[model samples]
Target chain A: MRPLTETETQTLFAKLANYTGTSLKNLIAPLDNGPNADRYVFRIQQSRCYYFTKTGKFRLHITALPILAEHARYKVWVKANGEMPFLYGGHIVKAHVGRWSDDCPEHQGVVVYSMNDTPLGFGVTARSTQEARRLDPTGITCFRQADCGEYLRDEDSLFATS
Target chain B: MAPTRTTTIKSKHATNKSGIQNSKTSSKARSNGSSGDGVSKKSAKSKRTTSKGVALGSVTGKGAALNKLRKKRRVYTERELGIPTLNMITPVGVEKPRGGKKGKVFVDDRESMLTILSLVHAEKDGQIESKMMKARQMEEIREARKAEAEKRVEERKSKLDETKEGLKKKRKRASAARELEGEGGRREEEVKGTKALKLKKTVSFA
Candidate 1:
């Protein structure tokens, strides 16, 4: 039940900024000395951060909203055959990649999606789009970091009551 | 009518033959439908015959007359009466109403938005405050440790100086004591030599 330190805040913000971009500022506005001060608070428990009202009700634990994916700059669309494999924690290969954000840089964070625009997960590009075009079909394109399918596969650890 | 009855009888015979074929082909079709194309074609032929048999039965049955009578009587409603129905005409630029279906727009209620903003503000402020406090504590600890180290270094330097000064004083005292011992030893030797000369002269006179 402690507050997040400076480094932890910076790391969290940096990761969130990748998805939310400038919209993150709207979500986390600076506190004002005016009448509407001290209404909410952030607390950490067992390494899980929570944002809640000062009255200890109406908490939001899943702070990273999915809308962030919509505004993300770097994106990779996986083919139908690759969707299941990506959800299963496999990296995106060239054969399974349907499309990608134009001029995406290598090693940058990217949001992964299905061909129909359903966001599947977040990953880091293994190669730039130009480099990926020259790669073999089996070559790795993006390395998956997390996926929405973890809700089912990692249910026990993700939703720990403790 | 006689021809139609003969066709019905022929279809009945075909259905019997199809029943036997169905039993024989069911197992083979179950294994692989692709390999049972001939069986499927036979089944399609049987289905066509069954449909014809149904048509013939309808033609001969009493229900056929009832179906004809029902088709002739036209039940007219508002459209036939030339009356306008309840379907409203949408205005030129107005979008059609989407009934019962969920819309894509995510509406954040005022209360919920306030709650979220407050939480964000609290988290940011608390994090910043905690970070500053931690940094202040670390700086204090660092200063304390540095001061203690410097104090220890000064103490060691003074102790080394005191030890060096004591060694120098001890060396000076040892040198001075050696010089005095040498002076006293030389005087005692000279007196002993003079005494020995006087004793020798007195012994010769006697």
Candidate 2:
């Protein structure tokens, strides 16, 4: 899950438009990558996970599918982080290559819908990094995957309005 | 060699004590312990692995901004490992690897892509299940092979012991035969007795 170079990006966007029946602008819209510097945002349902980079050669979203979830233990490099157990049973559906996820609708959590090739928000939850700040020590960013959309500050939490 | 006269001085206690020898042996043992004993280092490590205010990688208990940074830093992708890879990112200024084929995420058909994505998702789950079952099967095979090897080793060892015992008995019997030859070699008196006895028998018969 390397970051797309400008050329790769263009190619991916082209592919997205080709497959989604829309242009890159139509599919991606204005998720906004301008003031954010290396940060890129795309809608994956209500869930919004944040990733920061001094280097942006690889996409954080792609890495997350294998690292955070159960089916992502495909990479030998990732198994070293002591996270192989959590992701061992989970497998990622190659979004473009072939058809795979027909019978296992209940197993949608194991499947990842790519933003570049398929339905971007197919099964993504509307979570933020705020609740997930407890896992970070850097204090520069945070994440959340809660259905309630709770944002955590320094020793404080702000609940989202319904 | 010149000191032919021997004089013995008796201590307060007549008994010869090995206290000095015992002390030297204990001192040697103590020196060995100081250099080789791992007890001190083990204790120190026990103290360090136990203390924990926070886990650096857990991404929990850190402030909002820090949590996000840690998550990004620990990110591992196909690009990092430099594998034959495919991904979609904003490719505006990012250069391609030297001589590597530049790939793009293209949609020739949206409806088809959506259908394909769903299919891909299903495929990934089945693949994981199949992989797990395969690993289990392989492990069972390895265990069976190991058990068979161990059984063969034990059988060989027992056979060797039996051969050694047979050799031991053979050696003992050969050694006893040599002892008997040594005993019978004392034949000087018997030779004289044999000659004298033969002469007396002939004289008595005459």
Candidate 3:
């Protein structure tokens, strides 16, 4: 676990900011590459952000949900339509998508939230914002990349940072 | 290219179907163990006896023939111990033969029963042990045969190598002999040429 250089840290931070559609400074004001450079840990105050290895992007952790909840630019809200359990289980359809950010394009990562604005999980847009806007009720709008329940079941903090 | 989302759902469904199959097989094995009869017989019976339709005389209601069809089949335990009521009904100083499933009967004599059970147990153990011994003997024979074959192959290879080596030496000697003969012929030719030169000199002098 080698410590990343300043240049490497800046590059990673830039990539993270672009992928997550968040300001670099706002996400991690004082970026700490931790002891190991191979793994990067960014914190907004104390809550750790979850990075989905499959997507190669930082996900808004269940802990960081409160902070990202107000930032509607990166959130997509879906109406359960009496299928709230299914939505929580990480199944989302076009009919379930009540509202979403207009800027989210096809393949862009976004935070999935309930109609009540409770963060559900992280999802990737299968259809473009334009296509999703015109999507049929039965069409699939997005696919869940990571569910909040996954990390919650582990019962361990992401990292121990005093 | 962006990955499709439907593949995950399809894979999950496949896993679920496989899981159900595994559970069904386990339950089938458990049923067979408890029933004493193999599942093949049970399945065969079910396949052969399909109800065509309810008969007109069959009673309808709680006592309906269909209710019996819906009822679960009872699995009987092993018929080792004799019936208790039959023993009580039997006259004093005389024991009746124990009746068992499908026309099979066992003697009520305790000594004969113990001897039969012991013989059956010994035969089963002997069969299993004999099978294991046969397998071990066959494995040993196979290994011995393999080793012998490998030894024969090595012997043949060595024999062939010796013959090939001898042939190579013979070829080398034959080539050396031919080279010596060629050298002798060339020397003889040179000697004849020198004699001819001497003869020419003598004729010129004369």
Candidate 4:
């Protein structure tokens, strides 16, 4: 790899800022002159973005941070009973929703978490918070976009050499 | 501006005279001295002529004198001549940060951030929509498959029930036929023989 172009950087930063907000600055900051200083660079590989140090000794996936869930503006917590279903690639139904960030708009990106504050995945809201409140138990609250369970279920495709 | 323009014309005329003198001196040096010595002599002569031009300009008028002094000062101060001051060489040091606090590493402008975010969203909108559509199609196919499987299971259950009912009916008919034969003739012969045998045994013992 090569360094990201201006447009690519802007797009990446914009997507990341949705979850990390101003905290993204810390990730992009230049390294100070010191023995332990590491210059982090962003690169794209196989259509996926990677953030890694200049020495290639350490790397970070764009979505590797659990901190994103913690800082996300739009969030949804599934109840204990619903966590397994969500991990198994099921959408969040109104009955399974324990809580959600207030004023969440429909079709917005949302971080999915367990009731115990463990981040499971990320998804898009199917309805606004107000609309969700009026939905039936079986109505979908958020569509399942991706979850940690894919690490196991999709291990073959994820780790394929090709 | 007028004085500067006149000074410029005077400087051009002075340069023309100096060029002619340089040609004459260069020819004389070539005949009188070696190449290296001639170069040094030519440079010294040109310097003298430039000094003479400044002196002449100063003698012309007060404005011309100021102009000559200003030009001389600029030549000494600005290493890169003709370029605007704004385009001058940057000092050797850490560059000051832009569009943020003095020492901040990242730009924190909310308006720019919002615009970038909107641009990203617009670019991804079509992609997300296509993905969602595919997912919806997959869900529909899954639901159809599930319904078909359930229907097949129900059909199998109904066939199993019908077969079970047929077997029960066959068992009932066979049992009824056995009971009818026992009541009519098959059981009467065995009961009559038992009575006859008991009476004969009692007679012989008496």
Q: Highest TM-score, which number?
A: 4
Model 2 agreement with the true structure over A1-162: per-residue lDDT tens digits: 233333334333332321122122323233455653342333221222323233422223332332233322111111122122213322222212122222222212322333232222112211112221222332211111211111222114222211
The DockQ of predicted model 2 stands at 0.01
RMSD of each: 27.2, 43.5, 36.5, 20.1
**lDDT tens digits, residues A1-162, model 1?**
665443344444555544444455544443676665543433466544544345443322222437557567678999999999988889999999999887565666788889999888887888867668879999999988778777788787666745
The per-residue C-alpha lDDT of model 3 at residue A41 equals 37
Colliding residue pairs in candidate 1:
none
All candidates in order of DockQ, best leading: 4, 1, 2, 3
Indicate the worst ten consecutive residues by lDDT in candidate 1 chain B. Answer: B103-112
Query: What order do candidates take by lDDT, descending?
Result: 4, 1, 3, 2
What tens-digit string does per-residue lDDT give for candidate 4 at A33-145?
67556656565554444542444322323245475675666789999999999989999999999999876666777888888888998887898776687799999999977
- Runs of candidate 4 with Cα error greater than 4 angstroms are A30-39, A50-67, B1-206
Which model scores highest in lDDT? Answer: 4
TM-score of each: 0.37, 0.24, 0.31, 0.41
Error of 2 at B105 (Å): 17
Every candidate's lDDT: 0.66, 0.37, 0.55, 0.68
lDDT of 3 by residue, A1-162 (tens): 233333333334433332343232343232445553242233233223333344344344455544444442456777767245434455577877778776455665567777887777666677766657667887777777656675655446555443
For candidate 3, write residues B40-144 as lDDT tens digits.
678667665454224422555655566566555666543443433434555545754566445423343333333443444455445435654665566579789
| Tens digits of per-residue lDDT for model 1, B1-206 | 89999997777666544444455454454556445667777887788766755675566667656655644647776557543334325443575566866633332233444454445545654554565466556657978999999999999999999999999999999999999998887778777885543324343554
Model 1 - which docking category? incorrect
